[model samples]
Target: FDQNPLAQMVVVGIKAGIGERNSNLSGNPQDVLKSISDRHKLEPTGEPSLQNSIKMVRDSME
Candidate 1:
């Protein structure tokens, strides 16, 4: 995404604590990087719910 100016990206952080949040769709590489860096502050908990995460992603895309 950083290499492609036309590409847009969204980031989702799923924690084992069953928490979820996402960076809204963004085309800026810097914004995407910042979103990831900011989300890294949260320590992961138990196992991530792939099902929940996928649902969240699908909802966000809509």
Candidate 2:
């Protein structure tokens, strides 16, 4: 679960694995995740990455 304001903007804070895509967004969640991951030096695996998770959570608090 991501908490970054950018992640919220990335996917509008929607939970994953629901089959439904993020609300009020363009393209797919995979695309969003990949971009987010790439920006944070993650592997863009589409699944949760430890680095991305930490970055997102930490970024959100600021």
Candidate 3:
């Protein structure tokens, strides 16, 4: 489904969770990156690209 509303909701929820967690942190760049990586278990150049996309969104929010 190209326009799945559920998928959008899930993304928003994820971003909100990330933002909330980030707000409580020290805001150190490396720490934030590591936190995201650890929480999501992200690996480089994966098929889904969700990790990079989430990271980019998180970076923009900062």
For this target, which candidate reaches the highest lDDT against the unseen true structure? 1
Global CA lDDT computed for model 2 = 0.43
User: How should the candidates be ordered by lDDT, best one leading?
Assistant: 1, 2, 3
lDDT of 1 at 19: 36
- Residue-level lDDT of model 2, residues 1-62, one tens digit each, is 24443443344221231122233343455667765554565223344345555565466558
Against the reference, the lDDT scores of all candidates come to 0.78, 0.43, 0.42
- Shift in Å, residue 7, candidate 1: 1.7
Residue 22 local lDDT, model 2:
31
Candidate 2, residue 51: CA error in Å? 26
RMSD of each candidate? 1.9, 11.8, 14.2
Residues forming the 10-long window of minimal summed lDDT in candidate 3: 7-16
Off by over 4 Å in 3: 1-24, 42-62
In candidate 3, position 15 carries an lDDT of 37
Task: Order the candidates by TM-score, highest first.
Answer: 1, 3, 2
For model 1, the local distance difference test gives 0.78
